[model samples]
Target: MDLREESLYLAPLYSRFPLTIVRGEGVYVFDERGNRYLDFASGIAVNSLGYAHPKIVDAVTSQVKKLTHISNLYYTEPQIELAKRLVRLSGLDKVFFCNSGTEAVEAGLKFSRRWGKERGKYRFISTVNSFHGRTMGSLSVTGQRKYQEPFEPLVDGVTFIEFNDGAALEEELKKGDYCAVILEPIQGEGGINPARREFIETARYLCDKYDALLLFDEVQAGIGRTGTMFAFQHFGVKPDMVALAKGLGGGLPIGATIINNRVAETLHYGDHASTFGGNPLVTAVANVVLEEVESLLPHIRKVGDFLGNLLRERIAPLDDVLEIRGIGLMYGIDVKSNARNICERCIKEGLLVITCGKNTVRIVPPLIIGEQEIKEGVYILEKVLKEGSG
Candidate 1:
């Protein structure tokens, strides 16, 4: 099949760009025409270590030589190791592995429901403009009305409150009947907005007051993307559970939901399961990815801070730049004009970028991206913005 023709067979779920990327390495991707472009989006925050990292490649190769997969019916060493690493890194007590961010979210939702059932409450509270995933359970908790409107008659009892509004969050929690309150510490798809310290602290206290589980959806902001392993650490507030994915496997698909011991006990045998979840191949890759991330976290943070500051200093003063909001490497620039035009211009300038909600440009390069790449990418971005305005 002509690869470009494959688009016709696929569902119209994504609004794809014109270029077709065939391969990637480090912070760069090459299209079918062999044009190189600096990858600033990092596959929407999934390629944590960037493309074709040696460690990730070796880990997957070695695991394939040993055992590619065995269903969750049996024990797997890689899965156990990965789970342990995630639990230790996240400060959570246990983990449930899955194949994607949405699956991890689904697992988290089920765990939250179970926690509430044991305590006799079933309501889940989430924030406005928050995104969980497209799956039914996750979709139900997501706050955006647009995503939920087409798939109405969704799972009920989910209350949507305004984010960064401490009083509103507390008032909703005061109802005292919620099973859990799920939120994205940094809303990724909702325009890359970070949570306020007061809001996070209030949510923690309210969950404790009413015995509700605090779930942080760090799928896009976790695994070194935000200069911290998880966004919750930045707030200094510990959540009971965290839904993670995107960067966990360094490129290979993987996701996980980490839960504390008290809340984890709610999930028992036969309560939930995924056939490909915790397979040896994916877990082995994840183990290496986690190790690499832990070892290089210092560099990631340093580079992220440098780039974030540079972007702020350079773009904040621009006439067309509305605002730049983010922490570390995850940033969103709200432009005065349409983001699509700016993104297209950047592509023409040999840079890969993605647009987020409204007029925002999402800048989420791989954690392993270096300073020079950041400088060059920003230079291209500056040129695009300047020329696009002209």
Candidate 2:
């Protein structure tokens, strides 16, 4: 069967680009027709190490030969090892693994509810423009009306405040009705806005005072994308819990909700479970991914600075550029025109980027992306922005 024709059988959930990527190799992907495109999108920030890293390839090959998968019913060495690594990296007590970022957010929400059950706190506070996940539980907390309006009467009691509004957060928390305050340290889909340090500090203090858990949804900004191992680290405040996915398993599928000892104690046996979560295959790959990311932190910082400088020097000066927002390898170019159109032009120019929010072009290159790739991607972006402005 022709792969292009077979794609029609799949659900039309995504407004996919008309590009058939057959394979990838180190910050670039090749189409079925052998056209190459520099990949700054990094599969929406999931490909931490870029495409076809030798170590990742070897790990997958070796693990597949030994064991591909087994249910969470029994002990698995890879799963246990990966949990340990995540716990260490996140500075959390325990971890609950799942299949994707949505699952991680779902689990974190449930854990928050469980923690507050005795206190009769079932409500949650989230911020505007934040995109949590598409799942019912995650969607309910997400503050975008366009996404939530269609799925009417969603899991209720989720209140939205302005992003980076400490006063608003405190006012709601002061009501003493919330189980948790969930936020993204750097809002990914909400135009790559980073939370203010004062804002997060306020949330931490208020959550402690109001007896609510502070949940940081680091799904899109974690795992070395922010130069730090986790985005929250940059703010100098630790969260009660963190939801991670995107870059955690490199290119593989995995998500983890990590909680501190206080939250972990609230969850008992059978309180939550996933049949395929923590399976050997993905966890094994995650272990390698984590180790590799840890080693690349310094490199990420270096290249992230380089990329940031390139953006400011090149793209920011363009007439259509509204603002440049982001940290580390994750940046967004807020333009005067449509972001999707800019991204399509970039794709045509043999560069791959994506959009966040309505007018922001999102650039989340691989952690392993280099100076040369940074220059190349920015060149395409600058060219596109200049043309659009003209």
* Candidate 2 error regions (>4 Å): 1-7
List, residue by residue over 64-170, the lDDT tens digit for candidate 2: 99888778878999999998998888888999999999999999999999999999899999999999999999999998898999888899899999998988888
Candidate 2 lDDT for residue 189:
94
Positional deviation of residue 139's Cα in model 1 after best superposition, in angstroms: 1.0
Q: What's the lDDT for residue 62 in model 2?
A: 89
C-alpha lDDT score of every prediction, in listed order: 0.88, 0.92
Can you tell me which runs of candidate 1 are displaced by over 4 Å? Answer: 1-4
How many clashes show up per model? 0, 0
Q: Alpha carbon lDDT of residue 284, candidate 1?
A: 91
Q: How would you encode candidate 1's per-residue C-alpha lDDT over 154-199 as one tens digit per residue? A: 9998998898887887787778778899999999999999998988
Winner by lDDT: 2
